[model samples]
Target chain A: MRSQSEPTQSAGKRAAPPYEQIKLFLKERLENGHWTPGALMPSEADLVAKFAVSRMTVNRALRELQLEGLVDRVQGVGTFAAQLHRVSSSLTIRDIHEEVLERGHVHHATVHLAKAESASATAAQRLGVGLNASVFHTVIVHYENGVALQCEDRYVNPECAPDYLSVDFTKITPTHYLLDVAPLWEARFAVEAGLPTAREAKLLGLKITDPVLIVSRRTVNRGVPITQARLVHPAGRYQIDGVFKP
Target chain B: MRSQSEPTQSAGKRAAPPYEQIKLFLKERLENGHWTPGALMPSEADLVAKFAVSRMTVNRALRELQLEGLVDRVQGVGTFAAQLHRVSSSLTIRDIHEEVLERGHVHHATVHLAKAESASATAAQRLGVGLNASVFHTVIVHYENGVALQCEDRYVNPECAPDYLSVDFTKITPTHYLLDVAPLWEARFAVEAGLPTAREAKLLGLKITDPVLIVSRRTVNRGVPITQARLVHPAGRYQIDGVFKP
Candidate 1:
């Protein structure tokens, strides 16, 4: 493929903004992994001279990149590359249905199964309950346009909500139900890349080695963990979000 | 290399536990980007036959994989691969010192510049304050082991905290000083990936096109935002953490 930014001056005249061109060039470099994480670039003056743009234009491109968390700038010093580390933010925890609808996409769910069950050792530890404690397990297959999208397998502590199993998961989501029952005093979550097994691959209509997005959440109310649930979404479907207090 | 698993067959002849072997294999694949996010694998029965293991063993591997947020399984259907989306979880949020210490590394910071100033239009809008509001701006360069790491540019709302310029940011972090003065009610934050410009790259000792982790936060007290800060960290050095209810 032709270079998106080859510095074709075209007689040193162009219609687009110089800063935009520089921005596009740098963006293309980043996307193509040319610069990579933790790599440094040329100085402002250097960029100006090379790109045949003013210092202000180069500053704008760099300023925006810094605001977007792409670069780090220091006064009396040169610029450097930024290390793109794992991000944990607050924008991802909204209800999936609400999120999808907010994006102007249709969303729906199919309750595959729901029931009361005994907690396993892992669940006991994570939920802070005794082994075999009465827990509510629910399995739901969410869909977008009748296509399987997510498989939500949740385990709720009955001590937090005794009537968990009695509620109809088909009408309301586990998130909404849990929030209604316990009011979400606090929560802890994690996201990571994962691979699905044959069963899961078939359900999502993906091939082996396709990436998946997994989110694990644990909720506490008054210092007591009310429930710990894991929500699974197929690749290219969902993301995570959160915020930090200064 | 030899398999990293415990033998579990008949007293003397059992092969490695399927879960351990599977986990190891998948770990290798992920590190190699073979079974990247959203990749699927064969079914339990197929894996069992392929590895010559019992269905129970394969079940154990698949079960743990789900807990780790690797796959999505649906009843009466198949499983699907999960995507390793951008850093989206709230689990990586933490104090810089804590994070560095947790990694068995050293942490340090150098205040490149710290001064009080007025909030710009974007800052005022984000903080939900009056136009041209008086604000405290502090720019810092955080480092890890003499390696320039993060460049933090912060703007504090003077309306929320009147004595914004009295403290010494050289000795303490803005986070520490802010918490001491304002009892936080809530915080909204965001994180993203991108590249940096010439000046920023110099301070962070990064190269061009290096991926950067940018964290922006706004804290509110009684429905009024007191501070809006942007923290930039080397993508390799920083991660955010959180827990979401439901």
Candidate 2:
């Protein structure tokens, strides 16, 4: 670990504020695993002397890092590196295929159903269409490293993407295809936990009574509804994580 | 229902944009229960004629409403009122007692444990304290309408709030008190579904095999660790909802 006695290598070359430079120094130690999670960090006084900066500067750097969820400081005890958690921003729309690939895991899908159908009352309500409107429906199961991860049932508004029936879903997910053709203008979603239906259980190879994490989403483009989807995953296998700035 | 033939009564007096006016018109209808969920909404042509505005104006109104989860739109079919779901932004921290009161339900809490003790390895890691450091621990169950709603287990770093043990929990929740004394600077959380532990199930009055929704949260203030908390709710009773803009 870089200590207070370490030489001040970049004293005059940097134009950034003292606090910012101190933050970078601390960040590098954390990122490089020199400062492990739960390990005590250098005291403000130590940092101030090492960087030849004011105590306020060191305090500001540490405070900013804490606000970013990067470190945790105790009043009288001292600051310590925070344990890293799965952090996801609610504003970002994540692609499951991309997520799996990023983790260096193989991704595959099994298409169960894909066809054009008259919208049911529930589907009609969610898709913002008149009763019996033509809508495309598809059901697919996604796998990561050969383990079932998600069961997706989606309803697409035909007016938004008339070519929905012709596309091969096995190669490209409905989400990817829609984003390519229609693009998302806005979205709303809800997350809940519940027992899976018999059919859903059978498809996911889970017991009927087993719990599942359910995510319901609706997306719109321009001034038109594009799609509504229900995503289900086995309990204990998936989580939705996030960070909040107050 | 207001029809296309209705005169635009406020046209000359209202200074808002045409689309904003149209949006308010639709919103009032939905809020007053004049239009029920799943009911078909007026078409764009109908809205344009009714508001005496261009088609683009009405389209923008409906599109914005759909993005807000107030309505659903279908391409050749027609727009319809959306079913209301629990929607929350991850950025906001919610108070469970206030949440229950907002639903017009009675809220109460049962305190199980409140004391100061040495931090365990896991607690120490989460709170960024050293081994055997003094930490305050509390366990409480929140009830809504006489049914148990949540079991909260929390650990607080004494350095952040020294009076953690002396507070009257029945009169004031730990969370409420903490926020009052030590406002949060940042927070991270995760939502998962899992089976409750034996002790948790007993406290929650649930069967051992029943699923539960678990939320783990860690919050810091000014680069200092304040608290780490775990909240567990019955699977069918609670959810974490969000809206995302892309």
List residue ranges in candidate 1 displaced over 4 A. Answer: A1-98, A102-104, A107-240, A243-246, B1-92, B197-199, B241-246
Q: For candidate 1, what is the DockQ?
A: 0.09
TM-score of chain B of each: 0.57, 0.64
Residues B1-246, model 1: lDDT tens digits? 323333345477666655787766654554444543445666887776667667767776765656555566776565555442212233545556556667788778887666666667876786778777777777778666777767877787776567867776656667766665664545777554344556666778877445455666777655677677766655555544564321
- Model 2: runs farther than 4 Å from truth? A1-93, A125-128, A221-223, A244-246, B1-93, B102-105, B125-128, B221-224, B244-246
Candidate 2 lDDT for residue A237: 80
The candidate scoring highest on DockQ is 2
What does candidate 1 score on TM?
0.39
Candidate 1 colliding pairs, count:
77
